[model samples]
Structure formats: C-alpha cells, structure tokens
Target: MDVPYDLTSYVRVLKLASTPSWEEFSRVALIAGAGIVLVGLIGFVIFVLMSVVPGSTPA
Candidate 1:
C-alpha cells in the first residue's frame, strides 16, 4: 500500500476544503435530525408490532 501517497492526497483535500456557511450547516443539520427521527419512529413501530403479534415469545 502507498501510505505516503494516500497521506499526500488527504492533505491536499484538507487544504482545499472550506468550512460550511451557517445556512449550509443549518440545512444539513435539519436534514440529519429528520433522518434520525424517522429512523427512531420506524424502530418504535416495529417494536410495538412485534410485541402485539400473537404467539410471539416475550423478551
């Protein structure tokens, strides 16, 4: 493996990268928060369904 080459590439990327503006950061944060909520809701629904199903062994 070419470790030095990989490190140079990563360093170049870091040098070229810029911080997100407040608006951009907020938009990303909102999208990420929505995704987290949606996943949690889906998991809760699945757990409730499993608990309510007939003949399922209790945990």
Candidate 2:
C-alpha cells in the first residue's frame, strides 16, 4: 500500500466534506425518526399478535 498516496486522498476527502445545513439535517433527522417509529410499531404489533393468538408462541 502507498501510505503517502493514501494520506493525500484522505486529506482531499476531509477538505471536501462539510457539515450539513440545519434544514438538511432536520430533514434527515425527521426521516430517521419516522423509520425508527415505524419499526417499533411493527414490533409492537407482532408482540401483541403473538400474545393474543393461541399456540403462536411457546409457553
């Protein structure tokens, strides 16, 4: 591996990368939050179904 070349490439990426704007960050956060809530809701539904249905889960 070329250490100097790798270091230069890493530096170039760091130079180009910038923090997200507030609006952009908020949109990302909202989408991520929705996805998390969605997954949790699905899991809760599954748990309720398993608890209510007979023989669906091991006693």
Candidate 3:
C-alpha cells in the first residue's frame, strides 16, 4: 500500500551501510559452514541407513 514511503528509509539505510568486520564476517561464515556440514551429515546418515536396513522403505 505505502511502497515508496516504506522503501525510502530502507534505501537510505542501505546506502549508508558498511562492509562487515573480519570478526563479524568470520562468525557468520562459521555458522553457515556448520549448518552446511550438519545437513550433509544428516543426508549421508539417511543414505547409509537406507542401504543397511531391510524393509525400511515403503512399497
């Protein structure tokens, strides 16, 4: 409804934003990396279980 009015301040704030510090960037990267690893491990475990367990799948 009030598109331009809302985006006006948001655009100004983005224009004034600065690059992330090394510490901040590294923290974000570490969290993202951990999330990716966790998902990958979960997928690998599911795959192993599928092959190792009999009648575990639906027909």
Candidate 4:
C-alpha cells in the first residue's frame, strides 16, 4: 500500500521545528509584556493623582 504525503503539513512542521525554543522566546516576551504593564500602571497612577488635585486641567 502506498502512503499519501501531505506537503503542507510537512512544511508547517519544519517551520515550527526551525523556530526559536520556547524558553528564549518566552523570556523576551515576558519582559516586554511586563514593561508595558508597568508603564501603563505608572501612567494610570499619575492620571488619577492629577484628577484628584484641585484646579488641574484635564489634558
């Protein structure tokens, strides 16, 4: 019996195997995500503080 080959699946598997390991990618991704969250939190705190102060114009 002859087996059928799926070229698309083979290509996808090869591409995934050639990609970077999860550990390396996850580390960079986590750092970037954390940085974004930290910046957002800081900006929110500043915004709240400014809003609570009297006579401050909203930007």
Local distance difference test, per candidate?
0.95, 0.99, 0.96, 0.86
**Clashing pairs for predicted structure model 4, backbone only:** none
Candidate 2 lDDT by residue in tens digits, 1-59? 99999999999999999999999999999999999999999999999999999999987
Mind sharing the TM-score for model 3?
0.71
By summed lDDT, the worst window of 10 consecutive residues in model 2 runs over: 50-59
Backbone Cα, N, C clashes tallied per candidate? 0, 0, 0, 0
lDDT of 2 at 59: 72
Where does candidate 1 clash, by residue pair?
none
Candidate 1 deviant stretches above 4 angstroms: 1-4
lDDT of model number 1: 0.95
Q: What does candidate 1's lDDT look like per residue over 1-59, in tens digits?
A: 99999999999999999999999999999999999999999999998988899878565
* Selected candidate, larger TM-score, 2 vs 4: 2
Question: Distance (Å) between predicted and true CA of 2, model 2?
Answer: 1.7
Tens-place lDDT digits, model 3, residues 1-59: 79998899899999999999999999999999999999999999999999789998887
TM-score of each model, paired residue for residue: 0.79, 0.91, 0.71, 0.62
| Candidate whose TM-score is highest | 2
